[model samples]
Target: MSTVIAFIVIFGALVFFHELGHLIFAKRAGILCREFAIGFGPKIFSYKKDETVYTIRLLPIGGFVRMAGEDPEMVELKPGYRVGLLFDENDKVNKIILNHKDKYPDALIIEVEAADIEHRLFIKGYVDGDEEVLKNFSISPKAVMVENGVETQLAPYDRQFASKTVGQRTLAIFAGPMMNFLLAIVVFIIIALFQGMPSNAPILGQLTPDGAALEAGLKEGDVVYTIEGAEISSWADIVEIIQKNPGKDIEFLVDRGGNTLEIPVTPEVQEIEGRKIGLIGVYSPVEKSPLKAFVYGFKETYMWTKEIIAAVGKLITGQFTIDALAGPVGIYESTSIVAESGFWYLMRWAAVLSINLGIMNLLPIPALDGGRLMFFALEAVRGKPVDRNKEGLVHFIGFALLMLLMLVVTWNDIQRFFL
Candidate 1:
């Protein structure tokens, strides 16, 4: 139950901040926001304020911003030329006509093609249906050769996206991730000022009898400097490095009597509640300070982000297995352990998680803020936006892929925990 609560708190805070970023920006930009919802599935509670509906749903996983006309497929376009084009059964070359060609001879011709085209031509020319002129002209021509095929109609609101200036659209898209970063910073500051900071001291305060440190000639008063040739600045660094190298022989540099000596220790394999961690019979000293606390908090947060990225890279390179990845269940268990340990420990974990959340959301993957930002960047570079349907389709596919990944990770977490 504690683990579940911790998970809820962590996930809810992160998601709220993420969606809040979009909501705030949308309102600031004068965009019509129809609804702001937290969670998915059926809405348990809802309220309307200032023409916006706010909803709380059954699940506490994440939230979303529902802006007006967010879905291009559902948008109704105003009546205009209403030019319709027909394609073959396979959506190949079909027929296209301009309803009011005489009144708007200079108007640009927009063509919807079945397959994606790399380069497009937008030139003013007459279509004689000649192969060479059609190829050279800047006009897009749908090959309307077949009948009884799917018909695609161009809506007047197709220009809605292209009509917005680059800056406005960019801001609208970037607002989500920018809010995540800001929320992370704010959470860090709050935790830093209120909860204080946790420290990992290298001094060997507690040692188990006949343990690795004792067996390796490490005394209680010695200050550890390095492990396995890697520089250890704090207790956190020592714990992280040692945890990853369980049951492995390691070299340690300790300071004793104003003399530095190297000690080789083979950590004992210890099972703690079905999980394996290297046991060196050592305990890190806990320290707290006002100035060092805040600085250290930020540094620790930054380091956590770097470490996660490094782990991901290593996993991709086959240095680690996918089983190393953790899902919500794993996080909940870890959070429970931290909470049980003490307040300082919980604060440290929270800080680390916050940083991780901020960095992960910035990845250039679909269904993430980074991916949307990438699309915006492409639009800015091309001086035109991608087709809304196409872009939406890509994001939909991405979201499906991400959900599949989550399911796999969750399954792994369950197997590791119970099986």
Candidate 2:
């Protein structure tokens, strides 16, 4: 149960931050965002703020930000059609009721002669079915239209994704992945601040309760100079010596505050990944430095990012198998193990996953942010945008293929873990 909660919280945080990046930049570019959602299925909760509907959906796997002009509008006004309009104090049309007109008895009934909701923001029609005299009314930029009891705000031509500069659009798309990386760095910083950074020196920091080290009267801050007469220079050397001599007694020469002492200790034998190893259960010493903590945050993030990119490069170059990929089930299993370790370990796992998510989204595959950026790049070069129909078709196919790949990966994970 703890594992499930940890997985949900970690996954939800990751998705939320990524989508938030899109929402922030989209609004900065004056684009109309219809919904900011953290899942894909039926809505569990929803609230509207600043003309954006924030929703939490049933599925916890993925999320999206729906921006105006990214897709076709669900409702449209046609010429020569009859509709009813409600006006605000400024006499601008605030609501255009397509049906259920009785709900707003004060709404002016008109037969539409022509309407330009996007740019000109005017609705020209004959009042109350009078066709002889056509009247034109201005529409407020924030006006909404109701169709079948659903209210949808009208997005002006200047307030759309495509209407913005190519640079602005590119930033809006790239910000999602960028925000993921930033989230990882912040998590690492928090971990470092709360728990000091680990060191690699041949020194002990904390000892496990009832472990061999504590049982042997070994105290924290003991610098192990030698184990069984073999010199221990670094923590790696100590690990190698102890792990090799499982269930065997070893002599440790330690310097504890300038006092050299000889201690006999036996490492407990443990089986890990089918290999027998020894453990005295001592943690490496760490230093608590605020400046170093901030530095470690970026350093650790960069290191992990570099390693992940190299692994992805191998996968792209056919050096790695497709089965190496992990899906939700595999992540859950890993999360359970990490959760058992402790809270800090779980946090580190979340940071690693965030970095991975950031890198994967930056891959130039269609239907992803990288794919949209590719189109924007072409537009910059060609002096015109790609045809919307063609681009939409490409994205549709790419999304379908991605879903199929996810299913395959998830099935593989289930078989590997459960069966």
**Most lDDT-accurate candidate:** 2
Candidate 2 lDDT over 1-419, as tens digits, reads 88899999999999999999999999999999999999989999999998999999999998999999888884667877778899999999999999989888999999888899999999999998566898999999999999888899999999989899999999999999999999999999999899889878899889999799999989999999999999999988988999999999999999999999999999999999999999998888887778988999999999999999999999989999879999999999999999999999999999999999999998888899888988999999999999989988888899999999999999999999999
Task: TM-score each candidate.
Answer: 0.59, 0.91
Error of 2 at 96 (Å): 0.9
Candidate 2 colliding pairs:
none
Instruction: Give Cα distance to truth, residue 265, candidate 2, Å.
Output: 5.3
Summarize candidate 1's per-residue lDDT along 20-131 as a digit string, tens digits: 7778766666565667888999999998886468998998767888765565432122223233333355543234444543443443343322222112412222233332
Taking the candidates one at a time, how many backbone clashes does each contain?
6, 0
Of candidate 2, the 10-residue stretch with the lowest lDDT total is 73-82
Off by over 4 Å in 2: 208-217, 225-251, 264-280
The CA lDDT of each predicted structure is 0.65, 0.93
Candidate 1's TM-score reads 0.59
- Write down the lDDT that model 1 would get: 0.65
- Candidate 2 at 368: error in angstroms? 1.2
